[model samples]
Target: MEQKSVWLDEIKFKAKPSLKEDINCDILIIGGGIAGISTALELKDEDGVVLIDKGKIGYGVTSHTTGKLTYLQGSIYDDIEKAHNFKTASRYLESQLYAIKMALDNIKKYGIKCDLEKNNSYLFAAYDVDKLDKMKKFLKKTKIKYEECDLPVNIPNINAIKVNDTFVFHPLKYITSLREIIIKSKVQIYENTRATSISFEKDYYKVTTLEGNIKAKKIIICTHYPFFVIPGLMPLRLSLEKSYALLSPYKNEKFNAINVDDEVYSVRFYKDNIIVGGFSHPLYKNINYKKEEDKLIYFYKKYFNKDIEMAWQTHDLTSHDYLPMIGRLNKNHPNLLIATAFNKWGMTNGILAGKILADLALNKQNKYADLFRLDRPISFTKVTNFITNNFMVGKTYIGTKLIKNKDFYKNVHIEMIDGKCSGIYNDENGEKHIVSNTCPHLKCSLIFNKLDKTWDCPCHGSRFDIDGNLLEGPSVFDIKLK
Candidate 1:
């Protein structure tokens, strides 16, 4: 099946100019998805704020989300409270509400036509009664109003907690509108210009790309995953998971909904279609991407009787502590900021990060700043997750590297080139393309994503085209082609 989001086809965006020479700015923001673009919008009034992306704005993982804008995320409050504290979870709730208001206000102010609709959102459960009870207790403790209701689908014995005044919209449309506003303001925007590396000079940071270098007083690493590895230790603290979504004609599904099952499913409506998204799992060697996609379709077809219109996939980084990490990159690098690990709640978290990051850069005080501090102290709550995630990383590194077999599929094989690992794919037209199988970022062996026909690094979320061109990265360089 072809892998493309239904949201991508809703807007026809004009191309922006790519960076071709070195430039100086007050602040440099990298990554052009929701977080990067929203940060640019917040900083537009400030002088000399520049943003750059490897691809076009709004085309990354943001384009592939379910696009639900709700503060009542599925069991997020319970998870955060368990991982951190009640105060931290409450602050997280505040940030999400603030983000939703910010987005809605901006859409109204800019007259953005993004199909925004006020739909109730729900957290439902069939078998996970304990989890659902915990969510209710958290909601009650926070004083957020919710109601018990029947499941919207045909599923039996399922109950849901619903929050009114929530919303759903076309994310690409909203992002495109925001991009236009930022471009018209003081922000300098560039696309197709990747930030390859960063170095500190006397006082400022120099971000270099193939096109040129950008010298800025402050740098924000908003790329889905920060390319810098030293202080953040992102690989040790995070894990990558891929999720699938299917869009098809709708019937009577009313509210945006998700369940609290181990194998979770979230369904929402857009245009005349119902988008059912779920089937998330950690990235690992020899996992069949096609089978994952099929599983999503099968579940949707079993529940709803509609022909699938489009199917797609998205990848996300989940922080070990469950809450997002947003603040300075480390204790020493105050001028460097990092925002990542939204835990599949990027829509609200990304927007909220923009607000928090802008405050940090502009020297303004944000109430929720300390809640998401990158230098947060290690606690007993975080210890178990840290050990489990890091152990999995080690397993992925050693396990994928040890596979020496050449035969993968009929046309794809792993072999040696110049005494190093290489993947060779012979297309239907009999053209041979060979590229390194080792990720340039951490040397983790790459896995073939058959559904997208890209080489994916299961360890750090780097991706490359079959032709050896970098698609997404912490790895700024492409796989070596021979």
Candidate 2:
């Protein structure tokens, strides 16, 4: 099966050219996904604003999302309440609700043809009755109206909480509409422009790309995984989780629901397809992709008699504390901002971050900004979690070095090239291609992702093509070819 997002195929937009020369702008936004575009749209009135993407706009995480936008995230409020406080949870919910409103307002005002649908969102629990009760109590405390109901699906769930005014939409189509407005508003957009390094030159920041440099008064790093390491140190604060998703013939479901049980299962409908997403794990280990797909199919067959049409996978950055870090990259540098660790709910958090980042860049005050502040004091729990998580990554990095070639796949193995480690993939046609096995970001050893046929860094979620071309970041440089 081809690895592609159904949403990407469902919409089309004119492509923007890569940056060909050095340019200066008032603000520079990197990463052309939902967050970057939303920031550009919020700054539409500002002149000399530029946005650049390593690939095409809306083709990154935005296209690959399950596309459910709602404040009823799976026990997230409860989780926040446990970790922080009720006020923090309320602020998070308010930010998300405002994001939903902004999305709806833009869709109606701009008349975006993104198959937007207003529906209720549900969070159900099968065996976790206490969890459901706790969520209900939290909602009651917040004065948010929620109903307890039996789930419509065949699966046996003890209870489900339903919240109204939730939504699902074609993310790419929505992005198309946003891009149209951004273009008209004069935000210079450039695709295929990979940002390599950033530096401070006098009062302005210079962001160097593969083709040219962009000098701007301020910069927003919305690259999903923030690239800069020194100030932000994103890898230490976040862990990457990969999840699989598939599309099937539309099941007439009136609501989008997710179960935050031991195993997660999120379901929503867009157009004639029901998007089933979940089965998450850290992607460092060898995964049986076929087995995961089988699980999704089995679940579908048991409830709905529909054949799966498309399948894909996506990665999300989860903060140790459960709240997204959305503020200055470093406390010392007020002009540099970042937004990461959405924890698979980027549809709302991503856009919400854009608004916060825009406010920071424009010197406007926002009430919810402190909830996701970048320089917040790290709790003991966060510190311990960070240490434990990095230990796993380090283990994987060392273990990959010790694994012998004889134990590798029939068509793939690792070997030394000019005294340097390299991965060798023997294609079905019997042609062997060799590329450096070391990730350029943080020097973590790369693992071959058989499902996607790309080399992935277990430490920070950087991805490179089989030919060593950079596919995604936190890593900006491509792996060296032998």
As a TM-score, model 1 comes out at: 0.97
Compute the lDDT of residue 257 as modeled in candidate 1: 85
Q: How many pairs of residues in model 2 come into backbone collision?
A: 0
C-alpha displacement of 116 in model 1, angstroms? 0.6
List the global CA lDDT of all models: 0.85, 0.83
What tens digits encode model 1's per-residue C-alpha lDDT throughout 1-482? 34689888777777798998999999999998889888898998999999999889988889899999988777788878888789888888888898899889988888999999999888888689888888888888888999998777765336688888899988998889889889899999999998989999999999998789999999988899888686436777777888999888886757898877777888888877788998899875336788888988887778776688889987888887788888898767898998999999998888888988999999899987888888787767677887787788789889888765667778888998788789888888999888999999989988888888888888888999999999888899999674
Compute each candidate's TM-score over C-alphas.
Answer: 0.97, 0.95
- Candidate 2 per-residue lDDT, tens place, 332-397, comes to 789999888997888888888889999999999987788899888777777888888878877877
* Candidate achieving the largest TM-score: 1
- Itemize residue pairs with steric clashes in candidate 1: none
What 10-residue stretch in candidate 2 is worst by lDDT?
A: 283-292
Question: What value does the lDDT take at residue 444 in candidate 1?
Answer: 92
Q: Which number leads on lDDT? A: 1
Per-structure clash totals for the candidates: 0, 0
Off by over 4 Å in 2: 285-291, 404-407, 480-482
Where does candidate 1 have its weakest 10-residue lDDT segment?
Answer: 150-159
